[model samples]
Target chain A: MLVIEDLHVKVGDREVLKGLNLEIKSGETFILFGPNGSGKTSLLMTLMGFSGYKVVKGKIIFKGKDITNLPVYERARMGIGMSFQRPPTIHGLKTRDLVQMCAKYAQNKEIDVLNLAKKVNFLDFLDRDINSGFSGGEIKRSELLQLMAQQPDLLLFDEPESGVDLENMALIGKIVKNLLRGNGESPRPDVPMKELKKIRQVSGLIITHTGYILDYVNADRGQVLMNGQLCCEGRPRDILEHISKFGYKECVRCLNK
Target chain B: MSEQIKIDRFKLEGMEVEQDLQQFVSKYKEELEMAGIVVNELERSGTYLHLNQNPLQCKSHQSGLEILDIKDALSKYDGLPDYYWKAVDKNKDEYTKLAASKVHGGYFIRVSKNVKIKDPVQSCLFIKDENVGQSVHNIVVVEEGAEVHIITGCATSHKVKSALHLGISEFFLKKGAKLTFTMVHNWGEQVEVRPRTVGILEQDAVFQSNYILLKPVKIVQSFPVVYLNGSGAVARFNSILVATPGSYINSGNKIVLNAPNTRGEIISRAITTGGEIIAPGVIEANNVPAKGHLECKGLILNDGVIHAIPELKGTRSGVELSHEAAVGKIAQEEIEYLMARGLDEDEATSTIVRGFMNVDIMGLPLKLKQAIDKIIAETEKDMF
Candidate 1:
């Protein structure tokens, strides 16, 4: 479980996330819908402990502990995984190798590198650098592989469906859904049953604009994030349908009232 | 004589190099030869020297490439250095540029245009004789559109008091050409190395140089210069100098972009445990549309010293020039990032350092690119 209590976050000189509050519980998926630069990514980065975002006020609690000052990897170690909207291209690190490294980190044991490559359908690309020269779809799939490998208790996705095309959209969705539904961050080496679940066990906080993900991923709740604050919360399908009809204008009315 | 007195001869006559340089080669043959560990033989294309070491593959000198043998390589530059071809050689008896010796220590190398060499040419410099000094000049000219990779390695184990290496290299990059140079030095604890290098670039040419070290040297000073005399020229210098115990690596690089749209990059990295490291470099971007950037990163693995001073002088307002120099211990957050992933502190340190160095070394020969990767990995290994 994770909680953001009235957090005020500043990215360098600008106060990006002004007095924001949100929560996500185990076995539930929370979706944060926002326009571009609506502080969605900033919130995600702050919660993930990226360096630049200074928490001027409020606290971020993950698994009942305050991690306001924790670094990104430390938070990642504490069962928190993130899918960057635009993942950086690391030229010499193979996508498959990075996935295996993440998996090994999660399992505390060697995860066969080739197996991870095949799992992401990247066996042919096992020699290519991480995200370097990758198609957008391949990058999205690669991120899904890392998320699955990490098997975090709380998975935060930033624009998961943004760049992927129809060719890889379904596969990415399926993998994302599986990661959300999986337990223990990694499949147990001996116990195969733990991976047999029809739905993922991960608690997720997803940020999106297109709402296309609502088709494959089940969202328990949807919140409107506008101008750095959560304006409203409701069921996923209802909130998505309203946005499709009028846009953030409906949220603006609620903000005015 | 019970004393250790060093002697150096600057410019010898048109003498036989193989015989004249015999004493210098014999002195440190054993030690310099040990610097090589085998690497993938499949990539033996560059100028390289590998010591036969077990466990770790000997330094992969050759990248499985078909080179015009040294006989052929030395044959092209048959007499005196080239100018706009006007020569002022001291002797006409010099048969070729390879035969020309106007300086203390010199070399002649030629790379044909559009020819992509597979392995790095190797140079193993070892100084074992205590009282004698070695002065050699080198001239390397890469013709238009030709490409080559070169690696020079040093090894010395004998506890000799004084020996010197005065090497000068002139690189001529013809139009649209490329040359990659890598040097790995591990001198004896008390030896002096003075090397001067300069490269002249023609239109649309590129030059990349990487100088990495892990030994505690006595006095290693080099002023490597790159003159961009043509349009759209590019140059990058990467150095990772680790000074252990009593050592001094005074390294510097100068880039002057005279032609329009030229660019240069200088990067100096050092890991000091003791002694002093002074990395002072400058980039002069005088022409419009030219760009130059200098970055220096230093890691004090323990105690000791380093002054990483990067200076940039951009006279042309249309030119873009920037310099950043950072000297500090390993970041705690970076360490914790590796530790959380289950690597020990040293492993994490090495991993981060290697990651910092893992910038794409792609254009190099397979062996050299692999050697760079392997040695970087080796540097991560714990050394007490």
Candidate 2:
């Protein structure tokens, strides 16, 4: 669903992502394990077309279109969605209004905002200003709520479990799993597993430092990013085990080799 | 005070409403509606309509409520010995002096003790003749344990381009009383407006004031002050202002907490396209266990100017006072955050601006709220 070739990104005077190449096929969930300052967020931001993350040399192909230089809103309209790690607090813009805006381009069925908000337990905050004085878990749920409304083909998440508590983590994890699996709310108990797997089309690219998301999402592949480069590629669970056992120092060595 | 107006340039009399009341209401309904006044009085508790120096209508439909012209009230109450010019000083400025010298016509509303009026009392001060100078004096008194709301709209007729409006208003809230006063202004492009206002609150009284001005004018300036005299009294002020090209507006509010357990807050939002705006707010706490806060926010869209000054003072050992002031363009981060939600830049910008000038907290009437929203939409076009 998304392809990046020789993506070299510069934030200010320093280059964050140097000659990076990655690709995720349709219905695939790719887990990225990276240390701090390893350019995980920079990559997500570059793909979303945020300003200040200048692309010195890159070509971002999304759904067969070259979107490397597209404006942020155009990219968002073209089925690219991102959940911000630290979103801005927009005073006076109600959360309910924003959710409705996200669902403005829905194709066929009408979106019931109240019902969607109930899934995220955010009904009480619908009239409040977006992201104003929200706790960490509330921010995550708010982001997930908007993403569900957008129903984008490709989803990008930056540390879904950073500030969430244990109880909220379980709730957020289940919602994220449902969103990535292309099943909203209920997964159709009558449909066979094989048929459901074949029909899934949503793609996800998640960045994680603690690997807590693995317990919820059945990711197909994983990679370790160290010093602006990706080196290790293997099963998602195996990579998590290796990193937890030896830390990122072993990944640095593997990159050098 | 820098640019002085020649008071002699405007005629003080002879701009009366000669038509029938019903005919006049139908003729100027559009302009009057823009200022938050409804011509139909079915849903209103009382209405006082003033045309230049003439008192066209003064009547009350609800019991325990009194509505009369200032002249009639003065004669009936012996010049309203306890209310007239009591809260506000008559010699404070040249505009006050003019209003005190020749009181054209204004409203005198009173709520009887322990009476709770549900519908708002509406007043309109309209100018319909060019080069006409209109002066008025308004007085409102809420008796002990009473509750009421007053909405005053000031506007100039569409054909009247150049005029002068000078208004003086005073409010008094007795013990355990509650009052909400909302004022909306829609003046002509060449009109000059000067208003002087003050309020006094007794023990356990609550007062809220909302002011909205969203049209162009030559020059307008006002600074209204409120005093919390007894313990447990509270006061709040909220204002929304906008200035278009060639317009100049200077306005603010001040509150003083003089008794223990009193609280005061002042909040204002201003936007300027090509005109100039000066907004200042002040809150002072003088007694123990008193608290006050002042906030002023301004947004300068294009080549315009906005100056926000917020101040707070605490004179007692246990008083708490604070202030927050910001003046600049809309933050780039806030704009991009909206863009990421699939809205284009223009849509995102207007949405942010609308939120910045939000009136949801004011609890305004539905019709008045819709009128303000329309004005905001029209103002956004000029901003872009």
Candidate 3:
């Protein structure tokens, strides 16, 4: 479960996230949509406990506990995971090392190195530095790998569909659905086997920018975040189609009203 | 403290095993062969690396590293090259040696005029002793228009008391010739290390070298000098060292550019955690068309540690020489961030330390750089 109550954020003198409030229960998939620099990343980074963003007023309750002031890594330790919009390319740390570290932190389990790599086509890059020279799609998939390894209770994804190709997008959607549906088994990727059958293990709060995820994923609810505030709530497709036709002009009109 | 400033140092009897030297040479040979370079029994030319007449040699478009060394290549040379020699010197002219174990510890390497070799020649100097002495005299000469790479690594295998290494390297880079020398020092605890090195660059020639010192020693006094004597000659010196816990390393590099359109760079990074490190490096360009730079960085990991006294002296303003020095410590925020991510304090510290020392040994051979990293890491664990 995830809850945000009257969140107020500011970068320098300008207020970004203005008293935003939202809630999502366990097993519920929610999509947050916003225009460029419309405080989308600011909201996500604040939730991730990033520095430089002052959470002036807000209460973020995850799993029935208030964690509005926890550190990024602390949040990550307590079953809260995030995939950065622009992930850091930490050199000298192999991809597998990072995944293992995440797994140990989130689940206290040592992930099978080879099995983890085979997921999302990163077997050849297991020993490579995390995103050191990865392509866009590769970076997204690697982030997905880390998320899978973390197996957190609440996962916040920042623009997962921005940098991936169509095939990778489909794969990410299928993986998320499978993981959420309780299919937490690494069914030897080479040969067909029984799909991981567990359901509703993770509740995902994802950010979709271009209606790309709507084409592949069916979310429970959709929220429009703008100018540091939640401007509207509607179906994911309805919000996507409105944004496509009006290009945030309708949001501006509603804000003025 | 003894009044002996240790202006002169050399081991009377070395403890290095013969097999160690053979292993280093063998590795060097394998890499050379893979590059299509043939290392025969010194041949009549007395040149260990025959880049010109050897035919595998070609003119490089730019100056950087090319290949890392393979293992066990020196054994193929048949008991070292005939021309390799080592000696100690006062300043650039006088020689002094109270004792020496191997009068000839390394093979002599030379390049002829207008003949250039692409692959670098590597030498390993392992100081194996406890309360003993060792000395080596390495002589290198670069004739006009010739090029070469010289890499040397020094370490001790056994615990030793009162050890010393007095080495003098005299290099003559002739007209338009080039030479790059990389030296990594892994001296042991309770050891005294003193090295005297110099390079003389002639017209249009360039001489560049890098020195990396790992772990800590009671006392270390080594400064390599480069003197530009010909028109358009160049020289560069890069040194990195770490000192912690009662260790004091007084080391730096110096370059004198006296020619027109000549260039040189001197960069050094030193980290002191518990002891003191005094580094005052200088780069002096004495005439027109000369350009040089000097940078010295020091990081302090713990309190009660002296990371002070890092200075850079740049002279000859019209010659385009700039020098700077800095001292810092690891931030608490950085540590806390990493620790929150499930890594313990020690693991995070080691990770940061290892990351800090990943010098871009780009032009150096990959295997050679990896070997150096491993040695540095090993020494770092001991220091901690």
Give the lowest summed-lDDT range of ten residues in model 2 chain A. A102-111
For model 3, how big is the iRMS in angstroms? 3.9
Q: Looking at model 3, give its docking quality level.
A: incorrect
Kindly list the per-residue Cα lDDT of model 2 for residues B40-94, writing each as its tens digit: 8756889999988899999899899999999999999999999999999988888
Indicate the docking level reached by candidate 1: incorrect
Taking the tens digit of each residue's C-alpha lDDT, what string does model 1 give over A1-257? Answer: 88899999998889998898888887689989978888999888788776778999999999899999876666877888887766655434566656666765574345666665566687777677666687777777777767666667788888888878876777677777777776333445665754544234568998888887877787899899989878878997888888889888988888889
In terms of docking quality, model 2 is high
lDDT (Cα, 0-100) at B182 in candidate 2: 97
The digit string of per-residue lDDT tens for model 3 on B323-360 reads 67667765544444344454555765676566556566
Question: Candidates' TM-scores?
Answer: 0.65, 0.97, 0.64
Top of the candidates by TM-score: 2
Can you list each candidate's DockQ?
Answer: 0.12, 0.81, 0.16
Instruction: Residues B1-384, candidate 1: write the lDDT tens digits.
Output: 011223233112332323333353354444443454222234444333212110111232333333332223345546443731232122322222322333333334566667666555655544445533444445566788877776666655557555555455567889988888777676767677766677889999999998877666678877788899999999999887877767788887888898998999998777777767889989998798988899988878667788888888888678899999889877765554344333456655665566555645435445445655665665556332
